[model samples]
Target: MARAGSVAPRQRASAAPESGQRPGRRLLPRSRILLVLALVAALGAAGFGAWALYGSQWLRIEKVSVAWESGSRRELTADQVLSEAAVPLGAPMASLDKDAIEDRLLAALPRLKSVRVVRAWPHGVGLKVTEREPSAQVPAPGGFAEVDEEGVRFAEIAEPLPSVPLLEPDMADAPSVRRFDEERTLREAVAVAAALPEPLAERTSVIRIASYDAITLELSDDRTVRWGSPEDSSAKAGALTILMKAAPDARHFDVSVPSAPAASGG
Candidate 1:
């Protein structure tokens, strides 16, 4: 069987070392492939669950409940708040924007000092609101404007609050009032009121401000307390309390300088 020209063509092998997989086509181990598939399936399931919770009707909003945290008077009624909130009635609870709802409520009702809008699980949205309280009253166009503890004029009331004293600021004649700050006087007066002890504040009938430096309080009995400026208010308040108890008969008490306090008679 001596070969002729081809010499048996070098006896081609049937299962020669197959060229090791192509450059960009390496095959993964079977177990590794199975793990990859499991991971993909888990992600897909999570995605579907999210879609159902955020886009389906099973968890849609069925009710919006408004609750008051503080027992104070409500400037915005429950019905009014509901009407203003306009919470998407049929939207999925998970899709509802809690921050947007809170912003909307606050925008519609400035009387709401603080508000919390949250998903009350299953199918409801809950709102907890605290109404602004009137700390003092100032003369408005036709009635009186109520100022909250933060020195914000929140409402105009036809009748003055009996318990809350009136705040009078003499700014009409003082062009210099605008030189320092537009609301400096009113803010200072509110600070003074806030510094006073609750019992003393309740007894006070009026707070007068001639400037940021001149803050005075008139008691229910027509007695007076001269509280100058907002600086050292805590010290002034403490001094006033002790002075009042020490000289209950004094008609006028000056605590502008709490360290060297003074008391005078009519």
Candidate 2:
């Protein structure tokens, strides 16, 4: 023990920290918290989407609409298209077989060149259609069958179209018909008619197919063009234009060999 006068150096207070000092406030990692939040958001979005796509009546097809594409002329009315499409009412918009609907419309209507089936959001199914335009007229059993530029016979008319030319394939003992078939010959004639220059095409009254290589064009004025085969049609057209300009009075033109054209019978 030390002497009385001086207190033995007051016991130094322990400076050591207390044991188990709350380990850095155990906290959730920032990344873990963000991941949990993302999962919750994703679950919520998926639930909402499912409800909208299937469970909700609001997203069902309540109305159907039909429209022409590109202001195409209507051979069949909207009612006719709707009847043929027969899209199931009350079906979920997301559950619709759009391709099937399009196929149905095309199969049922020959006048349609193409069709687009659209989901008009919220509660509608829409149909957009393009109608085939007559490229030529063919004499059929009942009436003249209207053929498009692709040579598809789509519809029939009682009266002939004045603006369009008549396609006359020589089905009577033609050698080309025996070899290439009548359908092929008709297509070839259609190609020649389609390739005719603008005013000339408009003025053409008949496209006569005698043989595969013996296609001819008769203008409204009774002038004739020996167009020969569908091959080199562009060259033939060019030659015909030049020949017409050179000898406007000629009644018959032969442009089978575009390099050497001929005109006669003025």
Candidate 3:
């Protein structure tokens, strides 16, 4: 029976879920379906574009051109690099292996320091090469070998370069030779030669390397320059320039310590 002051408890609200979604579940929005369709269409278009780039004849490679860096002075020819490259012709530009071509050319030509293979739009591939510069001429069995800045004996030349100094190294005594590597004394000699100024370099005949610390330069006039080691070469060179002018009649110059240079034996 109902109480006098209070009506029966209000009937509990319906326990069932709303018409839109069940409890703890969600409905997929119509906007989301459209977004998903658009994303899939964009992905399909990208895939088709990639396929066309990979297989189309209109984008194929028709010509391969080789270029040398200006004033390289290397014996290599563009034809030689191109022949060694064996570029994949008639293939799509986007699918060609440029690195492989560059590696091939470098392997075939020791004088080549670096190489680049570029895709010229439409139908051409361009190859550019930078060759190593000879820093010194080291004596070999029958001829001289050109050494680069990194002490690499890159090429053999019949005659030594007049501008570059010749190196006379006794690698048999170097500890590195026993270790199955190039002698450090030889590199020290090359460093000494590569640092000489133009006047000294042109008149320089041969560099004698007794060891890393005993490097001597024999000039064309038979004058000697005692260069102790490869360190402080720039400072030593500058000091030598001043010492030569200060003592024009001196025949021997020692600038191992630029701070205390000496000249004697006129």
Candidate 4:
């Protein structure tokens, strides 16, 4: 009955999928496996990093050393600072309390102006120190106490340094005590000493303070400068410089009034 010239239609192939495998099931399992491997690797790296930073001996402090600014007077020895620091040896460097160490050092050593705690990587701690320099000397029991520019009496020395001047603040009178207390008087005298010119400061011998307005400076070679109070100190210093240059032979110089400086009695 079929036409002899036309071929019969070809039949289509029908294949069933394998068991437990959907259209994208094979790709999903492979993606999940890669994600789990990545997560495990990240966790392992974090654990190792934590152990290396804190729990490992390689990052722990083994040796401690102290270093100070060069050309500064070494008022405190390395042993003194170390003893006060009391840094825990064999502790992890990353776990050290830098601020605590600095606080202890400053509290124990009054001569230290500043302290910088540094981790000298791998196995050491370094303490960098800046010491207070003596601006003047105040008479204290058993010896002289060195005062810095801020009027802080830091150290006691048997003999004062030659370049440093002596401060004798006698704020015992009722009027002076009422106007300015002993502490303020001391601070004012220190301020005056600090404001002096370098050349005059080196030549100065003593700073005597009876009242706030009665601050006097006794210089070498029988010279004297009548510096009033701490007020107008900058102006006073400038006036004194010019007066001294103008009257080199004069023995008495008064710069209490910077506008009208006086000089007499060579």
**Residues 159-204, candidate 2, lDDT per residue (tens digit)?**
8888688999876787767688889888777777777777888889
* Number of clashes recorded per candidate: 0, 0, 0, 0
- On TM-score, who's better, 1 or 2? 1
Candidate 1, clashing residue pairs? none
Instruction: Summing lDDT over every window of 10 consecutive residues in candidate 4, give the lowest-scoring window.
Output: 21-30
Output candidate 2 Cα RMSD.
6.7
TM-score of 2: 0.80
Off by over 4 Å in 4: 1-27
Writing each residue's lDDT as its tens digit, candidate 1 over 1-266 gives 87677565587768555577554665679978999999999999999999889867789899999998967677778998888788999888877888888899888777888888888879889988888887778889979998887888877889888878789887666655767464877876877777778888888899988777777889999999999887898899999999999999999999989998999995
Q: Candidate 2: lDDT of 246?
A: 96
The whole-model C-alpha lDDT of candidate 2 against the native structure comes to 0.88
Scanning candidate 1 in windows of ten residues, the lowest lDDT window is: 15-24
**How would you encode candidate 4's per-residue C-alpha lDDT over 65-97 as one tens digit per residue?**
999978777968999989999999999888999
Each model's TM-score?
0.81, 0.80, 0.79, 0.85
**Candidate number with greatest lDDT:** 4
Q: How do all the candidates rank in terms of lDDT, highest first?
A: 4, 2, 1, 3
Model 3 lDDT tens row, 84-175: 99998899889889889888888888899999999998899999889998778988886999998788888998888887889887555755
Roughly what TM-score does model 3 have, to 2 decimal places? 0.79
User: What C-alpha RMSD separates each model from the true structure?
Assistant: 5.3, 6.7, 4.5, 6.2
Clashing pairs in 2: none
Query: What clash pairs does model 3 have?
Result: none
